[model samples]
Target: MKFSATKSTLVYALQIVQKAVSPRNPVPTLSGILFKTGADQLTVSATDLDLTIECTVPVTVHEPGNIVLPARYITELARRLPDVPILIETLTAGSAATISYGQSQSNIHGFPADQYPELPELPEAPALLISQGKLKEVIRQVIFAASTDETRPVFTGALLEIRDGALTLVATDTHRLAWCRLPVQADEIISIIVPGKTFTEMLKITGNSEEEDVTVYVSQSHVFFVTSVMQISSRVIAGKFPPYQQVIPREFSTRIKAVTRELLEATERASLLITEGMPVVHFNLEKDACVLSVHTEAGWIREEMDLQVEGEPLQISFNSRYLCDALRAINSNEVLINMTGPLSAAVIRCPENTQYLSLLLPAQPKPARSE
Candidate 1:
C-alpha cells in the first residue's frame, strides 16, 4: 500500500491511536498499530484486548492495502518528520513498510494486518445520548474516586447507572465515594461498570467541543463512545457495584455548611504535614464554625473556617487526601456536610439544587457506642 499525508495530520492520528498499544503483549501484532487505506483516508488502530483506540486522517492513497507497524517506531518516526508530505509504501515480499519524507526514507518491518485482532462491532443504534460537556464533567467528578487496586477489580471502575431517564455515575474505593447525576431520555434501567483508565483516556482525547453530543452504545460486555470523527470502545468490568444507597447516611446529627474552596484549601494545607500513608485530619464541628487540625511527625496544622453548623457538635477524623479529593471535585461554591457521628459516613452535598454528593468514611472509625 502507498499513501501520502501531511506530517501534522499523520502525526496527530498516530499519536492518538497509539495510546492503546500493548507494551508487552504475547500477540506481536497487538503491540503495533494497524494502518489501513481508505478511499481518501488512512485509518490507524491500536488495541490491548481490553481497550482500543482508532482514528482516521486524510491521505492520498495510491494502492489500497493494510499493514501493522510497530507503534513505538512509527509514532517516534512521525514525530520527527519535517513539515512535508510523508509517503508510505508496503512491499509484498515481506510485511515491511517504507516511509519516505523530504529527501530521506526509512524501512521498518511490520506484521500482516490480518494477524491483528478483529475490532469489535457495536449495534447500529445508540443506547443513550449525552452531551460531550456533560460526559466530560461526569468523568472528572467521579473518576478520581475509583480505586487503583487490581485485586478488587470492581472498585477500579465507575458505575454507570441509567434509570427512568436519569443517569448516575458513582465511584468508590471502599473509603470514599463520588456520585454525579444527569438526565437522559431513557425509560428502562441499565447499569454498567467501566474501568477508570478508560475514562482517563477518553478525557485526554476528546477536545473541548462541548457542542457535540456523544453517542453511546452499550452491549452486554462492551461499550462504544462514538463522535463525528472518533470512536472509543472498552470492555465493561464484569462485577457488581456496591449499592450506594446503603452506604450514604440518610439522616445526620450534625450539618456543617461551609465554602467549598476555603475548606478544600485548608484540607490541602493539612495534607502537606502528612509525609506518607493515609493520615487522619481532625474535624471539630461546632455551632457556627469548624476547626481542622492535623498532627503528624513532620508538624501540626490548625485551621478554623466559619460555617453554618446545626444540630449537635461532633468530632471526627478522616483521611486528609480523601477529604481534599471530595472537596476539590465539588463544583459548587458552598457545601453542606451531613454527619451522623464520629463513626458513620459523612455526606457532602452542594447547598444549591444540584444532584451531586460524595460520601467519605472516617479514619480509625469506632462504633457509635464504643466512641
Candidate 2:
C-alpha cells in the first residue's frame, strides 16, 4: 500500500486511534495499529478485544492495501516529522513499511493485516441520535464514580437506564455514587451497562461539537458510538446494577445549603491535617453556619464557614476525599445536602438542577464522636 498525506493529518489520525492499544495485550497485533488506504481516505484502527477505535482521514492513495504497524513506532515517527507531505509505502514483500518526509526516512517491520483478529460486527440494536454536548457532560459527571476494583464486575460499568423517554447514567463504587439524567427519545425501553473504560476513552476523543449529534447503538452484549470520522464499540457489562434508588433516602432530618466552591476548599484544607490511612473530616452544622474540623495525632485543623440550614442542627463525619469527589462532580453554584442519620449516606444536589445527584458514604463513628 502507498499513500501520501501531510504529517499533521497522519499524526491526528494516529493519536485518535492510539487509545485502544494495550501495552500488555496477549495478542501482539492488538499492540499495533492497523492502517488501510483506499480511494482517497486512510483508515487507522486499534483494539484490545474489549474496545475498538477506528478513525479515518483524507489521503492521496497510490496503491490500495492494508498493513499493521507497531503503534508506538509509527505514532512517534509521524509526530516528529516536519509539517510537510509524508510518503508511506509497504514493500511488495509486505515485510516492512517505508516512511519518508522532508529528506528523513525510516523503515519499520510490519505484520500482515490478515493476522489481526476480525473486527466485531456492529450490533443489531436500533440507534438514536443524541446531543454530543449533553452526552459528554453526563459521562464526565458519572465515570469517576465507577469502581476500579474487579471484585464486583457489574459495578465497574456505568448503568444507562432508558425509560419513558428519559435517559439516566448512574455509577457507584460502593463508597460514592453519581447520577445524571437527560431527556431522550427511545423506540424501545432498555437498560444496559457499558464498560467504564469505554466512556473514559470516548471522553478523550470527543470534543465540544454542538453541531453534531452522536449516534448510540445498544444491543444485548455490545454498544457503539459513531461519529463523523470515527467509530467506537465495546462489549457491554452483563449483570444487574445495584438498585440505587432504594439506597437514596426519601427524606432527611437535616438540610444544609452551602456554596459548593467554599465547601470544597474547606475540605481540601482539612484533609491536609488528617493522616493518610485515616482521613476523616468532621462537619458541625448550626442554625446559620457550619464548621469543618479534622484532628489527628500529627495535627488538628478547624474551619468555620457559613451555610444556609433548614431544620435542626446536626453534625456528621465523612472521608474528606469522598466529599471532594462529590463536590467536584457537582457543577453548580450551591449544593443542598440531605442527611437522614449520621450512619446513613448523605445525598447532595443542586436545588435548581434535578438532573445530577451524588451520594457519599458517611465515615464510621469513632469511639467518641466529634462535637
lDDT of each: 0.88, 0.87
Write candidate 2's Cα lDDT for 73-155 as tens digits: 99988898889889999998775899988888899997888888887676666567787777888998888889988889899
**TM-score of candidate 1 on Cα atoms, chains taken together:** 0.94
Weakest lDDT window of 10 consecutive positions for candidate 2: 205-214
Off by over 4 Å in 1: 365-371
- Using TM-score, give the best candidate's number: 2
Q: Lowest-lDDT window of 10 residues in candidate 1? A: 362-371
lDDT, candidate 1, 1-371, per-residue tens: 99999998888898888778997998899989999998998989998888888887789999999999999999999999999889999998539999999899999999989999999887777888889988998898888899999999999999998887899999999989999899898765779999999998888885437879888888888888877666789999999898888887789999998889999999888888888876678899889978998876677889988788999999999998888888888888988899999989899898774688889988983233310
Scored by lDDT, the top model is 1
